[model samples]
Target: MEVSYKEEVSVGALVILGLVAFTLGMFWLTGRSIVSKGIGVDVVFKDVSGLKEGDPVRVSGVTKGRVARVHLDKVGKVIVTIQVSSDVRPHADASAAVASADFLGAKYVAYNPGAKDEPLAQGTPIPGVAEEQFADIASRAASNASQLIENVNRGLNPGQLAADLHNTLVVTQRGMKALSEASNGPMVQQTTQTLKTVQNVMARIDSVLGTRDAAASGRRLDTLTANLGQLSAHLAAATKSLNELLTTMNKGEGTLGRMATDTMLYKNLNATLAALSSLLTDLKERPGRYLTVKVF
Candidate 1:
C-alpha cells in the first residue's frame, strides 16, 4: 500500500502538533521549563554565594522559573538573569535576594512581588541582597583594629612630642617679645610725631580759614557766601539806579537831565537873565533925570 502525498503532509503536521502538546504537558507536570517564553529580568548582586545557572527562581517562595545566566558585570558585580513566568510582574518596591533552597547548600533567587497597586517595575536591573558573611567581616575588623593599635603604640614618642610643645612655646614667647620691642621702637615714636604734626597743620589750616570755632556759631564759608550775596544784590540795585538815571538824562526828563540835554530850556534861561540885566541898567541911568526936577 502506497500513501498519497496529501496524507503524508497531514501525518507530518499531526506529528509536529503532537510533539508540541506532549512537550507542553511534560513541562506542566514536571514543573520545568525548557525555553523561556516569558519575561527576562536582570538582577544584580554583590555576591551570588554559589548561585549558578538552572537554579530555580521563586516569587515569594513559590517557584516561577529558573535562572537563565550568571555573569560578572562591568563593575565587578554579579548579574543574574532569571526567566520568570509572564504573570509574575514585580512592583516598584520589589526586591530579590540570594536565598538558600535547602540545607544541602543549593542557592536560588528569592523574588518578592510588592504592592500590586504600585507601578510596575519592569526593565532595568533589580539589585539583589547577597548574604554577606558578617562573622568573617567582624573578625577581620577586629584584627585590623588590633593591628592599628599596635602600630600607634610603636610609632608614639612622648619625649619628641614634649620637645615639640616646648619649641612652639619658645617661638611664641620670642614673637611676643619682638612685638613689644617694635611698639616701643624709635620708628613707632617717629610715626606718632608725624601724626601729631599733621594734626597741628590741620588745626592751623582751620584757624586760618576762620572755621576753627565756626561750629559754635555757623560755618565761616556759609557766612561769607551770604555776605557776598547781599553785596551782589546791593551792587545790582546801584547798577539799576544808575541805568535809570542815564536813561532819564538821555530822554531830558528830570531836573539835571533837562539842564544837561534840553537845548530849548537853556535858551529860555539865558534870555530871562539878559532881560533882568537890561532893566537894571535902564533904572540906574534914568533915576537922576527924574530926581532934579523933583528937588527944585
Candidate 2:
C-alpha cells in the first residue's frame, strides 16, 4: 500500500524522536547508576586550569570515578564535586589535586589517600590546595637555565688553569733546588761541628759532676748548713740581748742611760767641771797655795 508523503515524514520524525528519547533515557540511567554506586565528595581548588565536568578522577594513577560538577562558590572558590567508587575508602586526610593526564592539557582529579584510619565521608568539602601550574614551573626552569648559562660563560678554561698550576709547581721546584745547592756542604759541616762542640762541653760537665770530689762538695754543703744554723742561733741571742738593752734604756735603769736622760746628773756634771776649772786656775796663778806641803 502506498502512503502519503506527509504520513511518511511523520513516521520518520517519530522514529528519530524515539531514538532520541531512548538515548536520553540511557544517559539518565547511567547517571543514576553512577550516583548510587559511587560516593560523592566536594573538592575546592585554587585554580582548576581547564578542568571540567565529566573528567576522570584518579587515585594513585588508577581511574576511580569522574567529576560530576564544576562551579564557583559564593566566595569565588572553584568547587569541583567528584563521585568515587564506594568500594574504595578514601582517607579523611586524603588530598584532591587537579592534574594533567596528557600533553594535550587533558585535566583530571587526583586523590592521594594518606592513611587507612579516619575514612572520608560523603558531601564533605576538601580544602583548596596550592597546585603547581605548568606556566610557573616552566618559568622557574627557564630562570635556572639562564643562570646556568651565565655561570658557564664566566668559567675559566680547564687547560689554562692546569698550565698555571704547572708553572707554579716548576718555580717552586727550582727554588727548592737553588736552596739545597746553596746550603749543602760547608754549612752542614759547620752545623755538625757546632753540635760536636756542644756535646763535648756537656760531656766535660758530666765528667766533672761525676768525679769523687763531688762527694766532698756535698760534705762541704752540709758543713755550711751547720755553720748557718750556728750563725742564726747567735743572731737570735744577739737580738734578745739587744731587746733587753733597749728595755733597760727605756726604763732609765743603766748608768749610761741615766747619764743620757737624767737632768740632775747633767747639772751636777756641769758644776763639777766648773769647780775643777777654778781649782786649775788657782793652782796656775798661786802655786804655793796647792803645793805648800813640799817644804820641810
Candidate 3:
C-alpha cells in the first residue's frame, strides 16, 4: 500500500517519539539521571560484595543515582564511582557502604549524609564498608558448629562415662549399706541403753525430790532473800551515816570535826597530853605523893 504523505509524516514522528522514550526508559532503568552528569563521588571498599557499574546509588535509603564505574586500585581496594542526582550532595563526613538490594544478591551503594552541618567537599573519596553476605555468615556458623561437634566427640566417651557412673553408684551403695549396718550394731544399742538409763535416773531424781520439799525450799529461799534485802538496806543506812559523819568532820561542824580541822585545838590537845604525861611521870617518880592513901 502506498502510504500518504501525512501518514508517512505521522510514522516518522511516532518513530522519533518511540526512540526518545526508549532512551529515557533505559536511563531510568539503569538508575541514571537524564539531566546532568550529576555529582561524582568516589567510594573505596575492601570488597564491593558484587557491587557493579549500573547499580543503584541510594542516599539515606532513597534511590538517588547509579554507580558509573567500579575498578580495583593498585592497593587492591575496590573503588566505585557514582554519579548521584544534583540534589544528592553529601558532607565530607558522609559514609558509603555496599548494601544488598534484594535477596537475589543485587547490590547497591548505600550512603549516609552524616552530620548535615559539616561542609560538603566536591570529589572527596568516601570510605565504604563491604556488606556481609548471609551465605558467608551461615557458612562460618556451620563451620563453628562442626568444630564444636568434633571437639565434643574427641573429649567425651560414652562408654567411659557410663562405667564411671556405675562405679560411683556402686561405691555409694556399699557405703550406705555399711552405714546402715553400723547404725544398727551393738555399740548403737549400748548408746541407746545408756541414754535410757540416764533418762530414768533423772526421772527418779525428780520423783525423789518431793513437791512439798520443793515448795518448802522455794519458800525458805524467798524468806532468806527478804532477810538479805533487809540486811542490805541496814548496811546502806550505816554507810550513809558513816559518809555523813565524815562529811561533818571535814566541814569542822562536830567536835571531832573541829578537832580534826582546827590546828589550834589540835595543838592544845597535844599540850594537855604532854602536861598529863609530865604529871604522870613525876607522880611515878614519887609514889607516896601520888598514892596518898587514907588508911587511917
Candidate 4:
C-alpha cells in the first residue's frame, strides 16, 4: 500500500509539471508577454497583406515588439495593435509598414522611428502603409503577359506573310520559265550560230595575221620604205641643180642672162631688123627687073 501510494503521487506530479511546461511553451510561441510592461500603439493600414496577431513588430530590422491584435476600424481599414517594449522609446511620428516575412504569406510590421527627441505616448495611432505583395506583383506580371500576347497577335499576321511569300515564288517561277523558253527559240538559235561563225572568222584572221603572213608583210613594207627614200634623195639633188642654174642666169654669166641684161646689144639688134624690113620693101616693087637680069 505504501509503494502504490508513492507511485501514484509521482505520476500526478509528473502530469502537473507537463501541463505547466505546455502552458509556458504555448504562451511563448503565441508572443504573449509573461510580464505586461509593454506599451500598446495603434497602427492603421489600408491593407495588411496577411499580417496577423502575434507577428513581430520590428524597429530598424530588430524585433522590439509584437502585433497584439488585428481588426478593422469604423471606416473599413485594417488596424493592427502593436505592443512595444517599454525600453523602446519611439517618437510621436513613428510609422508602420507591412512586409513579407517568408515565401508563405507570413508578414510583420516594420517601424520607422521618426527623428524626434520626444517618445510616443501609449495608445497613439501610428500610420501604416501598404507594402507591395508578391501576389499583386504576380498578378501584374500576368496582366502584362496577356497584353504582350495581344500585341503580338495584332502586329504579326503569319498567314499574310506566307501568302506574300507564295506570290513572290510564283512570280519567280514564271520569270524563270520565260527565260528558258526564250533561250530555246529560233531567233536565239540563229543569233548563237551567227556569233559562232563570226568567232571562227575572227580566229582565222588572227592566226593569219599572227603567224602565217606576218614575215612576208614586214618584208614588203621594208622594200616600199627603201624605194620611197631613194625617190626623196633624187628629188632633193634635182632641186639643188635647178637652183644653181637659176643663180648663174640671174648673174648675166650665160646667153640668156646677156640678152636679158645688156642695153647696147638690144639697140644694135633693133637697127639690123629695121634695115632688113626696108630692103625687103624695095625688092618687092622692082621684082621684074631684078628677075630678068638674073635669068640672062
Tens-digit lDDT string for candidate 1 (72-95): 976659998888787877667767
Assess candidate 1 and give its TM-score to the true structure: 0.35
Kindly list the per-residue Cα lDDT of model 3 for residues 1-296, writing each as its tens digit.
89899999999999999999999998888766666577888888888988877898888788888899899885659888888777767786888999898899999889876777775676678888998988999999999999999899878978888888986775455445444545754445555655565565455445545556877767656655565565556556556665775687668776656655565775797799999999999988999986777866
TM-score of 3: 0.56
Clashes of each: 0, 0, 0, 0
Q: At residue 223, what lDDT does model 2 achieve?
A: 56
Q: RMSD for each model, in Å, please?
A: 37.8, 32.0, 32.7, 39.3
- TM-score of each prediction: 0.35, 0.44, 0.56, 0.53
Relative to the true structure, candidate 2 has a C-alpha RMSD (angstroms) of: 32.0
Q: Name every residue pair that clashes in candidate 3.
A: none
Candidate 4 lDDT, 19-58, residue by residue in tens: 9999999879988776765878888899888888889989
True-vs-predicted CA distance for residue 287, candidate 1, Å? 99
Better of 1 and 4 by TM-score: 4
Best by TM-score: 3
Instruction: Give the alpha carbon lDDT tens digit for every residue of 1-296 in model 2.
Output: 89999999999999999998888787575443333457778888777888888788888899888888889775558898888887655678878888888878888888765586987775678875645778889999999999998787668667778988986775455444433654544434545555565565556555555668967757655655565565556556556655765566456676534544565765697799999999999989999876866546
* Candidate 4 C-alpha error for residue 70, in Å: 1.7
**Of models 2 and 4, which has the larger lDDT?**
4
Give Cα distance to truth, residue 87, candidate 4, Å: 5.2
Ranking by lDDT: 3, 4, 1, 2
Judging by lDDT, tell me the better candidate of 3 and 4: 3
Overall local distance difference test of candidate 3? 0.76
**Residue pairs in clash, model 4:** none
